[model samples]
Target: MKTLFLLLLVILFISGNKPGLSQDNNLQKNLGADNKVKIQSIIFNDIETGIVNNDVKKFSQYLSAQTYLSLINGVNGYYSSNQAYYILEDFFNTFKVVSFKIKETKTAESVSYGKGDYYFEKKGKREVAHLYVTLNKAGSKWYIAQISIN
Candidate 1:
């Protein structure tokens, strides 16, 4: 009877420990994911507004120092913060934005990404382009790391 009771106790302890280890792994995976939802919303909303209104200053406010931009027919490459600002300014000048809408937004770990559609006019011709932007979180703030329009 003594040996049987010891075995039962050991089994129960092992079972409890297994679940705790698994739970800990899950908790670690989900850590740092909370509190990002609101930030992502605000940043994406600001981006949408800036594009729709062709406000380079407002858009530049969120750009990372190493921001990269790839446009369909214009500039394409990694650019410094100031260079990107001017490139965007030129793009906006060449194509007048009629509408900008975000279709999807996703966040993983320290990175947030979005996809949308850009409707604009260039030389009296309407054009539609797909837009993608990726943002990286630094401390308590998010910065636009890359942008693509095609």
Candidate 2:
């Protein structure tokens, strides 16, 4: 009986030492992920508003240090945030936004993509184009890493 008691005690000690996944830890991690998704959604909403209103000022704050843009006007490549701002400003000035709407969005752990419709008029010629933007999370903030209007 003494030996059996020692064996049981040892078994309990070993099992208790195991770091099996805890429900609280899992819940915390899930909440963190939910917060990130919420942030992505909010940022995308701001970006959509900016595009719809033809006002980069609405979302320019989210531009990454170096942003990649492929504009219909033939400006393509990575550019500084300041340069990207002016480039987008120029595009908006020339195209003239009739409407902009985000049709779909996908979010991952560290990146998110938004695809939408851009209806614009150039010198009274109205057309619609596909708009795609990528957002990358750095630290606790999301930044616009890429924008393509095709």
What are the root-mean-square deviations of the candidates from the true structure over C-alphas?
A: 15.4, 14.1
- Cα lDDT tens digits for candidate 2, 1-150: 999999999999999888553322333444563455376676788788888888898778888999999989999999988999999989999999999888899999999999999999999999998999999988866789999999
lDDT of each: 0.82, 0.85
Lowest summed lDDT across 10 adjacent residues in model 1 is found at 21-30
TM-score of model 1 (CA atoms)? 0.73
Regions more than 4 Å wrong, model 2: 1-37
TM-score of each: 0.73, 0.75
Number of clashes in model 2? 0
Give lDDT tens digits, candidate 1, residues 1-150. Answer: 999999999999988777553323433454465633356666787789888889987557778889989997777888888998999988988988989899999988799999999999988999999999999988766789999999
Q: How many backbone clashes does candidate 1 have?
A: 0
Error of 1 at 57 (Å): 1.2
